[model samples]
Target: MPCPDGNAGSAGASPRKEPITVTRITDAALEVVATEGYDALTIRRVAAVLDTGPSSLYAHIVNKDDIDDLLVGRLSAEIVLPEPDPAEWRGQLLDVFSQIRDQYLKYPGVSRAALAMVPTNLEALRVREGLFAIALAGGIEPRTAAWALDAISLYVSAYALEQSLVLQRREHPDQEWVVSREELMRRYTADSFPQTRRYAAELTSGTGPDRFAFTLALILDNLCPSA
Candidate 1:
């Protein structure tokens, strides 16, 4: 079959050619995601970046989900979990969480995708297995460990997504239709939630790492039997 228009082979029979390689499409997609956020990630955009056509991308990646999965898999390769240290499993877990967050933040939109996927890719699976091992070694019940990992993953991914979304909005200030949304919320919240108004500074006290540490401490206090 002929390759899609605007993506014809540089020199070949007819206008047809194989789809762009896995690396090219993914790198292009990552660029778009990092620059434009997930909503801007599309086959056409990736094709534009790759000098290919949407059909060629579809020929290799089934749809948006496939591209998303590929993106997540590519980004997963960056995560580096430390060796499971039985004596310091909690520290190890926090390190892994921070690593995952930092790596995904570089790509901007990958965290949102990671939030929705179970991370079946090899690297993600290995990381999950390692965390499970640490949890088990720490004397956590298998079921509890599994659930705690889920909770932690959800928290990290959601926080990353929200962070990216906020950054994107700030980058494109015109995109925010509700100009007074934050101020309005502050006023309403102050009136309706007096205690929240008083303690709002404390509520939003910490940076990402600080908040992550607080979260870990809270969960560990509940989950770790010795705590």
Candidate 2:
């Protein structure tokens, strides 16, 4: 029988393409999370991107958690860890955290995946190692260093996710959305909240970068007073 295009039968058939690999699956999953939120990321969604079945993705990644781990691990790998300088450990710690937050911001909603996750992946371990080393070198006790690392990671991830949510809301505004800090403060002042009205200026004081730097300095000062 002739082919549909009138070419030779069988000979006109296209060659089979390479099967989807874990890396390709991961890329698709990240893309979905970037466009939608992390909640939209699923094996089925990723499979749809590859024109495959969920089972195909499952064969490589165990489940949604595995994909989340991969996404966070890939992001963690991009962080540029500063060399452990004892005198500059405080600044280095802030730099490390800033890099982490910047990486999470790049992918919009990916930071949500790192919320309660432990650092089991190699790249994540490297990030933790760098932070821990900096803490210890700056005279932090072992127990305090461990807790500080956890606290810093949690703060950075949560802050990045919060920023992503704010950006998302701004991009797709709703009736309930408050457009500006001025409007937010106006509403607060109009309400019956005495403390909020009194400190409205202090509450809405700084730009995003300024608030970030102020908070970072606060944490560093409290954690490593001598440093």
| Best candidate (score: TM-score) | 2
Name every residue pair that clashes in candidate 1: 3-16
For model 2, the stretches where C-alpha displacement exceeds 4 angstroms are 1-10, 225-227
Residues 8-119, model 1: lDDT tens digits: 5545567555558878888899999878778888889999988777888766778887777777778667777677777888888888878888877786767777766766
Model 1 residue runs over 4 Å out of place are 1-19, 175-192, 225-227
Distance from true location, Cα of 199 in model 1, Å: 2.5
Model 2, backbone clash pairs (residues 3+ apart or across chains), number = 0
For every model shown, the clashing-pair count is 1, 0
Candidate lDDT scores, in order, read 0.77, 0.83
lDDT tens per residue, model 2, 74-184: 888898888888899999998999998898888887888898887577898888898988888898888888887787788888888888888787877563364688797
Top candidate, metric lDDT: 2
